[model samples]
Target: MSGQGTGRKARLAGSLLPPPGPARMLAVAALVTSLGFGGYTAGSVLFFTRGAGLSTGQVGVGLSLAGLLAVGGNILFGRLADRWGPREITMVVGGLQVVALLLSTVVDSFAMFLPVVCLLGVSEQAGKVCRNALIGGAVDGDDLVRTLAYLRSVLNGGIAVGAMLASIAVRYDTRSAYQILLFAIAGVSLFGYSLYLFVPRTRPAPRLRKKKDFPKAPPSISYVFTGLLCGIVNLGDTVLTVGLPLWVIGQTAAPKPMAAWLHAVNTLLIVLLQVRASRGAKTITGATRLLRLAGWTMAAACPVFWLAHDFPAVWASIALLIGVLLLTASELWNSAAIWGLSFSLAPAEARGAYLGKFSIGTTLREVFGPVLVIGLITGTGGSGWFLLAGLMAFASACAGPVVRKAQRESGVSDGTLARGRSGSG
Candidate 1:
C-alpha cells in the first residue's frame, strides 16, 4: 500500500471508533442504491398479479428462477469488482438495471417478463456486490459493521418509501405507476453510479512469494456454514416479499392497498431503527451473540402472520406490523455481524471471492425461500406461518456455532488481524 492508502486506512480505522467522511459517503451511496432496488421489488408483485395476471405459484417460480440467475451474477460481479475495482462495475451494472426496468414497462407477457426479471435480478446482485466491495475497501473493522448496518437500514428505508409510492400508483393506475417507478429507479441508479466514480480506487494487496512461508491455516468451514445459515434465515424475507402479499390479496376482503401498508411499515421501521441496533451491536464481539439474538427474534416474529389472516380485525394489522418490525430487527443484527465476519475472515488476496461466496447464501435464499414458502402455504394451507417461524429459529440457532467454529479454526478473530498476520507469516 502507498503512503496515501496507509493514511486512508488509518483514518477509516479511527472512524470505527468515531465517525468519518468516507463512511458517510459510502452510507449515502448505499441508501440511494437501496431506494432504487426497493421500489422495483415493491412494484413487481403487483405488476405480475394485477397487470399480468399470473398465479401466486407462478410468481414464486418466476422469482425463484430469477434468483438463481442472480446467484451467478452476484459471484461474477463480486469477483469483477474486487479485480477491476468497484467503481467501473457499479456503473456498468447500474446502467443495466435502468435498461431492464424500462424494458419491463413495455413487455406484458410472462415470456418477456421472465427474462427481464432474470436480468433485473442479475443487475440487482451486481450493484449490491459492487457497492459492498467499495464500502469494504474504504472502511475499517468496526466501521465496516456499522457501515453494513446503516447500509441495510437505508436500503430498507428506501424500500419503504418506494413501496408507499407504488401503493399510491396502484390505486390510480397500475401501468402508469410502474412507468413512473422505472424512471425513479433509473434516476437513483444514475446518481449512485455517478457518486461511485468519485471514490478513489484501492490498490490490491501484495501476494506472498513462497508457499512454505505461508502459515498453515484451517480451511474456512465456518464461512460455508454461515452461508447455509443465512440462506435459511433469509426465508423470512422471501416469505414477506412473495408470500405475504399473495396471502393478503387472496384471503382478505380488504382492498389491495393493505399490502402496501404492510410493506411500508416494515421498510420504515428498518430504516429508522437499524442505526441504533447496529451501534448496540458493536458491544457484541462474538458471532454467536448476534446469531442467537437474530434467530430468537425471527422465530418469535414468524407466527404473527396467522393474525394477518383474520383481516378487518384490529389485531391483524398490529400483529403484522409488529412481526415485520421484529423480523427487520433480526435482519439488522445478522447483517452487521455477517459483514464484519466475512470481511474479517477472508484472505486479503481473495476478499472479493469470499464476499461473493458469502452472498451466495442470500442468493440461494432468494431462489429456494420463495419456493419453499409457496409449497408450504399451498400444501398445509394456514400452517405456512408456523413452518416459516420454525425454519427461521432453526437457521438462526445454527448460524452462531457455525461462525464461531469458522473463526476458531481459521485462527483469525477479525479481518484486520488476519491481514496483518498473513503478511508477517
Candidate 2:
C-alpha cells in the first residue's frame, strides 16, 4: 500500500512540473526579474514622494512621457531584434535596465528622474518584444502559448512574494527603507536577468525583401486591425482593476478593503488556472473561438457588476466576488487567445517586427484604457456598463471573420493555420 501511494504521489508531482525547454530558463529569469521589479514598483510612489521630494504630478507627468516615447521605441527595438538576435537584444536591453534601475536609486529631481524613467520604460518594452520573439524562435506550435502561460504564472508568483516583502517598507514609509528597497531592486534585477546568458541563442529573423512591400513592411494592415481590436476587447482587464475598484468604493456599499481582496483573488486565480485556460489556443481557429468566448464572458460580467450596485453590503460583496470570477475567466480566455494569435499570425521570418507592432495596441490600451474606463463608469450610474457589454459582444462576434479574412489575405492555408506556424510575409 505504501509503495503504491508513493508511486501515485511521484506521478502527480511529475505531472505538475513544467516541461523542460528554453522556456524553463525564461521562466526563472521572469520570476527573478518580476520579484525585484514588483517590490520596487509597489513602493515607488512613496519613494519618489518621500525619498526624492517630488510631487505626485511631476512623477505622473514623467511616467506619462516615458510611456509615449516607448511606443515608437518598441517598433525600433523589435526590428533590431529581428535584424540582430533576440537573445542578444534581450541581454543588451536587460543591461540597460540594470543601469537605469541603479540610476533610479539616486535620482533626486524631476529632470534627472525623467530621462532615467524614459530609458527604463523604453528598454523594458523592448525587452518584452525581444523576449517574445525569442520564444517564437525557441518554441513552436501549441507549446508557444503554453510556455507563455507558465511564464505568466511564475511571474505573478514572484511579484506576489516581492510585493509582500516590500509592504514592510511601505508600512515604514521612511526614506531609508525606500532607498534600501530601490538598491535591492537594482541588485536583484542585475542578478536575475543575467540568467538569459543560459538561454540558447536564436537566429536572426530574415530581412525584408522589398522596400515597397507594405506601407509597414513588417506589420500589415490586417495585423494592426487585429491587434487594435484585441486591445479594445482586452479592456476587460482595466474594467476589473480600475473600474471595479472605483465602483465598489464610490458607487457600491462594499467595504473599501474589498477591492484589494478582489485583486488578490484575480492574481491567485490566474496563477492557478492560466495554463489550463490556454488548452485550446494552439491554432488560429481555436484562438479566435476562445476570444469570442472571452468577449461573451466579459459581457456577462458587466451585468453582474451593474447589479452589485443594488445589493446590500453582504450581498454586494458576494456579487462583486462572482463578478470578479467572471471577469477573471474572460481575462484567462482572452490572454490565451492573444498569445496564440500574436505569434501564429506573424511570419516567422519577421516575428519580432510583427510582434512589436502588435504590442503597440497593448501600449495604447495602457495609455487610454484607464481614462476611458474611469470616464464612462464613474459618473454614469452604471449605464456605461451596458455600452461596454455591447462593445465586447460585437468585438467577439467580429473576431472569427476578421481572423479568417486575415489568414486568407496572408495566403496561409488551413493546414498551416492548424499547425499554428508559417504565415506569408
C-alpha lDDT of all candidate models, in order = 0.68, 0.80
**Compared with the true structure, what per-residue lDDT tens digits does model 1 show for residues 203-319?**
444442343333222257578677668667666676677777777677544467667687666666666666566554443255456666777888888677666777585666666
- List, in order, the clash count of every candidate structure: 1, 0
Clashing residue pairs for model 2: none
Per-model TM values vs. the true structure: 0.79, 0.91
Question: Any runs in candidate 1 off by more than 4 Å, and if so which?
Answer: 1-20, 45-61, 108-111, 167-177, 206-221, 245-259, 280-285, 307-312, 316-318, 414-425
The lDDT, on a scale of 0 to 1, for candidate 1 is: 0.68
Per-residue C-alpha lDDT of model 2 across residues 1-425, encoded as one tens digit per residue: 99999999976543333577677888888889889877976888788888889998898787777777877888888877767677788888888988887888788999898999889888888888888887777776547888888887887778888888899898988888888888888888888878888887776423444433422434357766677778878898888778989999998889999998998999899888888999888778888888899989998998888888989999999999999999999999988888877777777766777888888877777667877888888868889989889988998888888888777776665434223332211
**Candidate 2 off by > 4 Å:** 1-17, 205-216, 415-425
**lDDT, residue 411, candidate 1:** 62
